[model samples]
Target: MEKKRILITGAAGFLGSHLCDRFLAEGMYVIGMDNLITGDLKNIEHLRSSEYFEFIHHDITKYVDISGTLDFILHFASPASPIDYLKIPIQTLKVGALGTHNLLGLAKDKEARILVASTSEVYGDPLVHPQTEEYYGNVSPVGPRGVYDEAKRFMESITMAYHRFHGVDTRIARIFNTYGPRMRLNDGRVIPAFIGQALRGEDLTVFGDGSQTRSFCFVNDQIEGIYKLLMSTYHEPVNIGNPTEISIKDFAEEIIKLTGTDQKIVYKPLPTDDPLQRRPDITKAREVLEWEPKTSRTEGMKITYDYFKNLPEAELYKKEHRDFRSHTKG
Candidate 1:
């Protein structure tokens, strides 16, 4: 059988790179596109010499020209981290809205199946305990974090519109907190923040008295969930994340144990719109795709720590730690 031809946006990112590796391992010919806005080439550099893998340096929001029938299109672009999107708010909104629309058009033209990497942030500060796909989010459009939140919500809307209007096969994976190797240490997310600080012997800053809760799925399980979703018949958005929730304070303690560092855990002022708690109801995912995260936090943290431990001494300790946490509490 001919290998499937897959194109992944944000292919150099943490999730995207891992997805590329997964697809390539499955004997698929993969085309990776990125403008390197938030992604580093080093992430995908290992595949530079692979005959089945091609990396394109371009923005997905811009026009994309390619040949061959595209078997799959995974749109994972956009600035995900608070530090990244906040620095380029306009780009974040544009990629989610315009970039996703463009890729949906590509899927229609090629009759390819496509998946958009949506985020738990779309649920805003959750009013429900564990947010299911049916819950419409409580978003603050005018807030500082609105750029990413509202943008992702718009991405999902456009994706569904394509599925409805153009008869395109689309899947939206509302990804939750995914952590593992290749996570940019300066992304301002809590996991990397705590790890980076502890590795460097700095304090672990916990925002808002450390009461906010989140579920972190290992990258391997997340990539598996996304791949299953892309290949399955299910078309609606599905929540892809671990259901086990942990408070920020407890998460810090876990990091302390994993790294075995005596870093001080400090309380800090919370940012606006941070969610009190967020976990995925993956019942739909399990029933439909038979997918559930297998890597527990303890094991995933060890893998991530091992990866970061190998980082160069300079990159390992030179990040300018910021004071504010992301408002998208999920």
Candidate 2:
């Protein structure tokens, strides 16, 4: 029997690297792609020697060229963190818009199933809590974070256009906040930020009175939902995340307990356009893909904390700002 061939963009990033592991476990020939912009090579370096794994060190937004047939394409490439997207705003927009288009084109040529990784940010300080797929969203097209949000919005739009007009098979996963091992300590998301602070004996910084809420999914749970979505026939977007939401202040407290640190929680003004609340309504996911998150926060956090704790001392203090002067067109 022939093994399925799969191409995963952003294959060196946190979630992307995990997806590569999942697919390879299923006996697929995996091709990993990344520009090393926000992704660290160490994430996928262990897979380099695998006979079934191949890597392409190229940016998807420029032009994508693969020689053989691909059974599936997972478009997970983008500067996913606020710290990253903010530093490379234009590149973030390009990857979501142009990078998605390029992958969609490749999927069409190969007649392959393609899934583009969408985000909860499309809800945009959502007027509707526990967001569902039917919501048209309340995103600001010109906000400071608009580059990433709008670009993903455009990604979903063009993807559907290809499906509807060009007869291409497409899937969209509207992912919520997810964290686990391999996450950069300086990614600036709440989990890593809080964990990093607790580890360094610094105060956990909470923005906007520490009242803003977010729901987090452990990486394994999230990847399971995504894998099920790829195998299912449902074509519309589906939400994949844990429904148990937590406030920034409370979450910081949990981190302090988990890390055994006496760090205090400190408040700061929230960044502009930061969502006041985020939670996903996974009714469609449950009914269609029959999926829900399985990892408990206590269980997941311990695993994630241990991964970061064992890292080199230098990584804990590293900052992730990218220099765009050397940025490629992708």
Candidate 3:
């Protein structure tokens, strides 16, 4: 039997690299694509020796061409973290909009099944509690964070259009906050940021009194949910995340405990357009995909903390900032 062939965008980033591992484990030919704008080559370096794995260092926002038959396309590109998107907002918008469009076109041409990774940010400082697929969302198009939130929203809209009008087989996974090994310590998300500070013996910075809530899904659990969704015939957007919620202040304390650090918490004003609460309503996922996160926060956090703790001392103090204007069109 011929092995399946899969294409995963953002293949050198946190989530995309993990997807590459999973697909390769299933004995499939994996084509990993990334522009290295925010992705690191080190993440997928280990897979270079595998005959089934190939890497393409190309930006998807520009024309994307993949030769040969493709059975699946997992669109996970784009700067997923606040630090990344805030610095490269235009690129973020293009990947979510133009990049998605390009991939959908590719999927149509190849007659392949495509799954675009959406985000919980589509709910956008959500007016509804525990966001569901039915909610329209409360996003501010002109806000600083809108670059990510709106891009995802537009991605979903275009994906659905392709599925309906173009008769393309498509799936959307509205991912929530996910953390684990390979997470960049400086991505500006709460988990890695707190863990990095604790490892460095610096005070954990809590934005906005640390009252805002976010639900974190372990990387393993998130990958499982995504895999199941792609195999299923569901056409609408599905939320894939652990519904375990925690406040930023309390989460910092948890990190302190895990890292065995004596660092105290320091408060700072929250960034504009930051969500005060974020939790996914996964009833649809449960009913359709029979999926629920099995990894508890305690277990997941310990693993994640240990991963960051073992990294080289230099990574602990390094700050990653990129100038994306040259690569991104105005």
| Ranking according to TM-score, highest score first | 3, 2, 1
- The sequence of per-residue lDDT tens digits that candidate 1 reaches over residues 276-330 is 8989999999999999999978899989999888988888766645322332232
Error of 2 at 301 (Å): 0.5
Task: Give Cα distance to truth, residue 116, candidate 3, Å.
Answer: 0.4
lDDT of 2: 0.93
Model 2 lDDT per residue over 1-330, tens place: 999999999999999999999999999999999999988899998899999999999989888999988999999999888888877888888898889999999999999999999999999999998899999888888988999999999999999999999899999999999999999899888899998998899999999998889999999999999999999999999999999999988999999999998988888999999999899999999999999999999999999999999999898988765677566343
Candidate 3 global TM-score: 0.98
The candidate with the higher lDDT, 1 or 2, is 2
Worst 10 residues of 3 by lDDT: 321-330
Over 248-314, each residue of candidate 3 has an lDDT whose tens digit, in order, gives: 8899898888888899999988899899999999999999999999999989988988899899999
TM-score of each: 0.96, 0.98, 0.98
Q: How far is candidate 1 from the true structure (C-alpha RMSD, Å)?
A: 3.8
Report lDDT (CA) for all predictions. Answer: 0.90, 0.93, 0.94
